[model samples]
Target: MVAAALSAETTRAALFLAATVGNVLGALVNYALGRFAIRFEDRRWFPVSPLARQKAETLFARYGQPVLLFSWLPIVGDPLTLAAGLLRTPLTVFLAYVTIGKAGRYAALLWLMPS
Candidate 1:
């Protein structure tokens, strides 16, 4: 949907804006899910186990905010953001780091792609 909207002649700018918004919103959604939906006791639907959550918390605690820079990575990235939210990390700081990470990832992708 984003690629298609970006490709369209009339709505290129709008589509790009929408894509950015959508990406950020997705991160927020992940955060919310991790905070409220995923439970340590209920592992069936959540998938992430208590041990995994503890590991992630430990890693994030050790690494600090810099861990947000990896928010664009596959598999682990989304979960990391969610864990951050679940941990109740400061919202402004999380958003700033996440936006930078996400923007960098998109910019790199665009640069690597052929025109």
Candidate 2:
């Protein structure tokens, strides 16, 4: 989607900005869901597993803020954002890491596409 937008005659920088903003918004939604999940964590039908949360926690412990750079990964990405909220990662800190990671991912994608 982003690449297609970029390929249009639209402003390249604006396209990039829009794409990054969209990605960040999606992550924030995941983070909010994570926060909400904490309240229902003990429910019988909760989707996210304890093991997944544990892995996210362990990775956060080991990598600290840097672990967020992997937030662009496909399967694991959403959970990482959720873990950030579940772990109460500071908002400013979360935004910084997430924005950079997401923007970088989009930038890389745009860069690799044929001009």
Candidate 3:
């Protein structure tokens, strides 16, 4: 959808803004879902494992919040966004980092598409 919009003669800045807003809103929804999952964290059906939890903790401790820049990544991206909510990342910080990452991803996709 974003690629189609960008290819329709929309200004790059406008497309970027729109894509960023929509993508960030979607991620925020995911974050809210994650926050809700806190109620079920101890259930047997919960998805995370001990090893994965340890790794995520270590990475956050070692790398700090800058690791959020890679939230645009595919398989790992959604989980990272969820983790941000699970860890209660500040709203301003989450918005800034996630927007940067998502905007960069959309910009790259637009750039690589044949003009």
Where model 2 places Cα greater than 4 Å from the true spot, the runs are: 2-9, 41-47
Backbone clashes in each candidate structure, one number apiece?
Answer: 0, 0, 0
Ranking by lDDT: 2, 3, 1
Weakest lDDT window of 10 consecutive positions for candidate 1: 1-10
Worst 10 residues of 3 by lDDT: 48-57
User: Once superposed on the true structure, which residue ranges of model 3 sit more than 4 Å away at CA?
Assistant: 2-11, 41-58
Tens digit of per-residue lDDT, candidate 3, span 11-110: 7668778888998997787566567775765678655554555565566667877777877776556666667777888878988998999989988977
Q: Candidate 1: which stretches are off by over 4 Å?
A: 1-18, 38-43, 47-52
Task: Give the 10-residue window scoring lowest on summed lDDT in candidate 2.
Answer: 1-10
Best-matching candidate per TM-score: 2
Give the per-residue lDDT of model 2 (tens digit) for 58-89. 88888887788888988677778889988888
Tell me, by lDDT, which candidate is best: 2
lDDT of all predictions = 0.71, 0.81, 0.73
What C-alpha lDDT does candidate 2 achieve relative to the native structure? 0.81
lDDT of 3: 0.73
